[model samples]
Target: MLDPKTGLPPRFLRTPDAARFLGISIRTLEKHRTYGTGPTYRKIGGRIVYTLDDLQGWTENGVRRSTSDETPCRVFPARPLTPAEKATL
Candidate 1:
């Protein structure tokens, strides 16, 4: 449902809804959170929430024009980064 003030979806979404928005399973999204590889989120009243803008920005990091095209940033898998990969970031 749209927020009355913004005429858009609510400013923040909880974990399950955010996963649905991104077309990924909730578990995957949780793993991303655990590994620090997911969209930015907020912890309010002890609940985690994600903003639409932050989700979009994280997805955009994976955008590419071609298979070989380089990206300015990357979206990593929901796992710990190797030391080499960490170095690059």
Candidate 2:
């Protein structure tokens, strides 16, 4: 479990350690890391490292509102605001 009290990154885990800790196959973790879809990690030299905290964070439990109450999200590129919107400044 992630020790929030410490807030320090958990001891780093090798691919096998991380896989065993999370009860998954190392190949699965490897696949996600390659595509950037899984828990955060660090790459040292040629090795991948996972933190206990990242594993714990993946399992945190907070309820999201139902789809009926969900708001559609709008994504924008990182750039200066449009002239019309900037006029308020």
Candidate 3:
């Protein structure tokens, strides 16, 4: 089957590439993963990967026609970022 993203066969995308595809920063994507708010991912041979289908599915969760539209979301960390983690930013 043709991959809707690149017109090639479907393939797993690494974090950086997947972040680019989703138009978000790698750090933001990482935060989503940390908070369990990101796309489903696979850990293969110790490397994190995302399938196009999963990314697309996750994207659909955020679809909104207006700012007033409410779609349940949990994209932020439960607690504020620690000083140490903030230093890395």
**Cα TM-score per model:** 0.83, 0.54, 0.69
**Which candidate has the top score in lDDT?**
1
Count: clashes, candidate 3: 0
Report per-prediction Cα RMSD to one decimal: 2.7, 10.4, 7.1
Model 1, C-alpha of 4: deviation from truth (Å): 9.3
Displacement of the residue 26 alpha carbon in candidate 2, Å? 0.7
Number of clashing pairs per prediction, in order? 0, 0, 0
Q: Candidate 2 on 1-89: residue-level lDDT in tens?
A: 55498976558888898989877788877766665556778889988887789866753422246645432321111234478845643
The segments of candidate 2 whose C-alpha lies over 4 angstroms from its true place after superposition are 1-10, 61-89
Please, what are the lDDT tens digits per residue for candidate 3 over residues 31-81? 788767788999999999999999998888777899777656533452456
Task: Name the better of 1 and 2 by lDDT.
Answer: 1
The global C-alpha lDDT for each of the candidates, from Candidate 1 onward, is 0.90, 0.64, 0.80
Error of 1 at 6 (Å): 10
Give one digit per residue, the lDDT tens place, for model 1 in 8-69: 87989999999999999999999999988899999999999999999999999999889988
Candidate 1 overall lDDT versus native: 0.90
